[model samples]
Target: MWVFWALLAAISAALVIVLTKAGLKNIDSSLAFAIQSVMILVITWGVVFFQGNFHEWRAIEKNAWVFLIAAGVFTTLSTLFSYKALSQGPASVVVTLERSSLVIAIILSVIFLKEKLTWQVIVGGSVMIAGAVLISLSNSRD
Candidate 1:
């Protein structure tokens, strides 16, 4: 079930990249990101309300709130930078580069979360980074 959800999210992210690239053609990236952020806020809060989970917000611990807020800050920065990149470059190249953040996430998870690292993760991250670099370089030549 988690795999299914992750796959769906991956597909949605791919669509977002293409759609955002198209939408950024006639507008500033920051403005485009702001419009998208509004929709994100509405939909996420709507989900919480629909699920009757709004009240759970009050139950969150101080440490959890701090981490959540930090995550939100990073998410905003990541999206803004992604939008700016998409506006200035080919979607394929931009998305490949952005998705390479998976490597960073893997490293951070192992170090910060004390997660176990396996050979598969190491090989996969290396390949992914290589692919992103290749795509970025290929785009530069064109």
Candidate 2:
């Protein structure tokens, strides 16, 4: 189930990069993302209400609220940077670079969440990092 959702997210993310790049051709990155943020906020809450989960929101714990708030802040920052990058570069390369954040997330999980990292995980992450760097350097040469 998780893999299905993750794959859908990946597909949507690709579409977002392509669509945002088109929309941002003449707009400031910040403004473009701000418009998107508004839409997301409305749609998210609308779904919650439609699904009758609005009441469940009150059941969320204090710690969960804190974490969700922090996540929202970081998500905004991350998205702003992504929009800026997308505005300045090809979406494929920009998204490839953005995917490097996975490595950082893995490292943070290991240090803060006490998640164990196997050699395979380390190798896979290193390969992803190398791929992003190589794509970047290749573009610079042209």
Candidate 3:
């Protein structure tokens, strides 16, 4: 079940990158991000309401609020940078680099989140990072 959810998240994130890049070609990145953020906020809040978790929101402490805000800012910056990179580079290269965030996430999860990296994760992450490097350097001469 957890693996299914993780796979779904990966697929969904890829779709988001492709769709966002296509959308950004015509619209301003900030405008696109604003629209996306609004829709996500509405849908998430709606789900919270449906789950009867609205009341629990009141118990969220100031530190939680700060963390949430920081997360939002980080997400916003990520989107902006992605859009900018997409605008400047080939979509294939941009998408590949964007997906490299998985490597960053794994590293951060180990460092800050105190997550243990099993041998499988080490091997998988190494392969992925190698692939990214290959993709980045392979076409440089062309």
Q: What overall lDDT goes with each candidate model?
A: 0.94, 0.94, 0.84
The lDDT, on a scale of 0 to 1, for candidate 1 is 0.94
Cα error, residue 50 of model 1, in Å, equals: 0.5
Give candidate 1 misplaced runs (Cα > 4 Å).
Answer: none
Please give the ranking of all candidate structures by lDDT, highest first, separated by commas: 1, 2, 3
Ranking of all predicted structures according to TM-score, beginning with the best and ending with the worst? 1, 2, 3
lDDT of 1 by residue, 69-106 (tens): 99999999999999999999899999999998999999
Write one digit per residue (lDDT tens) for candidate 3, span 28-127: 7777878888889899899988998888878999999999999989988988888888766766677787788888999999999999999999899899
Judge candidate 3 at residue 118 and give its lDDT.
Answer: 97
Off by over 4 Å in 3: 139-142
Let me know the TM-score candidate 1 reaches against the reference structure. Answer: 0.98
lDDT string, candidate 2, 22-86, tens digits: 99978999999999989999999999899988888779999999999999999999999999999
- TM-score per model over all chains: 0.98, 0.94, 0.84
Q: In angstroms, give how far residue 65 of model 1 lies from its true place.
A: 0.3
lDDT (Cα, 0-100) at 77 in candidate 3: 94
Report how far residue 59 has shifted in candidate 2, in Å.
1.7
